[model samples]
Target: MPPLNDDAIVLRTSDFSETSMVVTFFTRESGKITCLAKGARRLKNPFDTAFDAMNVCRILYYPKSGDVLQLVTEAKLTERFRVDSTVAIYAGFHVVQLLNHFTENFSPQTALFDLTKIILNDILSLNPICRSASLEDPPEKLSRCLLHYELRLLQLVGVAPSLRECVECGEKIEVRRGARRAAFGMREGGVLCPRCRPGKTRVVSLSPEALGALQLLASPEERFWKRLQLSQKTLGEIRGVWNQYLAHQMERPVPIFQWLKR
Candidate 1:
């Protein structure tokens, strides 16, 4: 068909031949795609180092009709993620991993792309006051940003956990104003009422504070960091529970997030 030209975030790249590379990029207009870059390893035209992860570039490629990988004709660097802190850098990597894992190939996912781009810009600036950073601990702020990204990505994919109600019974979750009684089932994918919860195995004890924080972060305010007052314990609980549910959905644990934990 015709050439595809778009802005893309480099997710991964591997050597294909002496002068080319096989690349997987999360494109703004085209979702995730894999293409072969002929002569990309050469420095004469200067595309050699442009395919690194977190680099945004404009690319031109010719598509193959069916399921075969396309041929990337050209790539021009756009924006590079200039990480400012350890947390921002790690968070950037986590965001890339999530997008690669969650996005379907060739699907039009503008929202995911937009969220990913914005976060990349935030983390790269490393401004202690970056919009995503609300806490004094830079790492914690970045970690929460990662969590925020995961929640939104899940929602875009239509499998977001049911935070407001019991996934088993579809009843609204009630926390009695200040009680820490909500239970989150990894398989059920949301908070289960005490009545709906059968047993404790494979479930996460989601406290009221954690629940409230999750709700606030996942709300439509868009500037979620401003609304957060999450304590360390609450952040830990949210991270643990959401990671569990996400792992269940993906049928495997997210590797980058696991590394971030360590």
Candidate 2:
């Protein structure tokens, strides 16, 4: 096929040969693509900046029929996100990691792309470390943000857990004590009612506030995130639920959380 022009964000890059590299990018128009960047490792390479992870660029490529990799012709950097803050840097990596794991090649994820860009911009602008430090209680706020992003990402990918009612008996759960003990059956893809928990089942405990926070995060409005708040205990509960849900769905544990724990 003839070379085509597209705008994309660099997801990853690795050395291919003496001077070239195998680069993966998620494009605004063409979705995820793996392209061979000939001579990208050379000092005088024109597409040097475009090969950096998280950098948005415009690329020209020729995709042969039934070929796994595309041949890159030209790439021009459009946005070089200078992430000076540590939190911002980690946030950027989290976005890239999620896209790499969850999305299939050539599948359109325009909403996910836009959401990631906005989140990255927010992380770059705010002092996440300082914000966490000054809080009445501090407990890995950056990690919490990452978890929130993951939950929303899962929703966008059509795998978010059902929290409204029990997936088993379709009963609306009532909050008890300070928390609501809902049985999150990973196999069933949602919560289980009290009556339906007769047999052995996997479940995650969530506080009333935590459930509310989850609902808010799953909402449609991007600006609605500003009004959302959660306590330390609630955040921890939500994180556990997200981790369990993601692991069950993906069949592999997310290592990014391990790095963030440090």
Candidate 3:
């Protein structure tokens, strides 16, 4: 059969032999593919720096049957990630790590692939002046970028937390005026209305401010992140709730969250 051609981002790589390497890529046409790039480690190989993590490249590979690895024929670098800011670079890695975790091989995820590219571009465009030394107290722009990417990735993966209605009773939630707190059920899966709040052992209370910020983060509006302003206390609340929710969904702690939160 003819080789399949598509755009892909390098997700991982490991040495296979003295002159070859095994690579995992998230492709635009194919969701995730692990392939052997013969001689990729050589000085003059079919793939050059295209295998570097987070780099985007155009790849040609021959697909295999079940449980068999694909064979990469040719690859050319199309884009390389900027290394100006440590915060931005870590954010990019967070994006790639989630993509690696949420996707399955041989499945097509074109929309997710496009979203990844957009988020990477946004991270790359951050001003050096707006960046910090680490993920702790990240600049507003970088924070927004990461939050948007996390929310969108949840949506794409079909596990987005429900913020509008009670996950238990399916009732629409209405926050009363001067309401200070709301309930979220991590295992039961999202915000819980007052009527459904009783007798739940796993529910956690969230600040109304943090809840509102979450709703905005989940919005489809392209510029919603920019318009939403969150105070430090509220940001911490949101991050805490979000991290717990993620841990519940994945059944384990996300390693990147440590670096991101620190």
Best by TM-score: 3
- TM-scores for every candidate against the unseen true structure: 0.89, 0.87, 0.93
- For lDDT, candidate 1 versus 3, the one ahead is 3
The best candidate in terms of lDDT: 3
lDDT per residue (tens digit) for residues 1-262 in model 3: 6799999998889999999999999999979999999999999886768898889999999998897789998998999986777777778888898888888898888988998998888777884744555566677667767787888888988999888788888887665557857889988888888888898878888876677778788776777776887777777777787888877887889877875552
Task: Give the distance in Å from residue 184's predicted Cα in candidate 1 to where it truly belongs.
Answer: 0.7
Name model 3 segments beyond 4 Å from true. Answer: 175-177
lDDT score at residue 169, model 3, on the 0-100 scale: 82
Ranking by TM-score: 3, 1, 2
lDDT of 1 by residue, 162-256 (tens): 99988888888865567767888877778888788887568878777778778877764567655566677777777777777877888986665
Considering lDDT, which of the candidate structures 1 and 2 is the better prediction for this target?
Answer: 1
Question: What C-alpha lDDT values do all the predictions have?
Answer: 0.77, 0.73, 0.83
Q: Please state the error at residue 71 of candidate 3 in Å.
A: 0.8
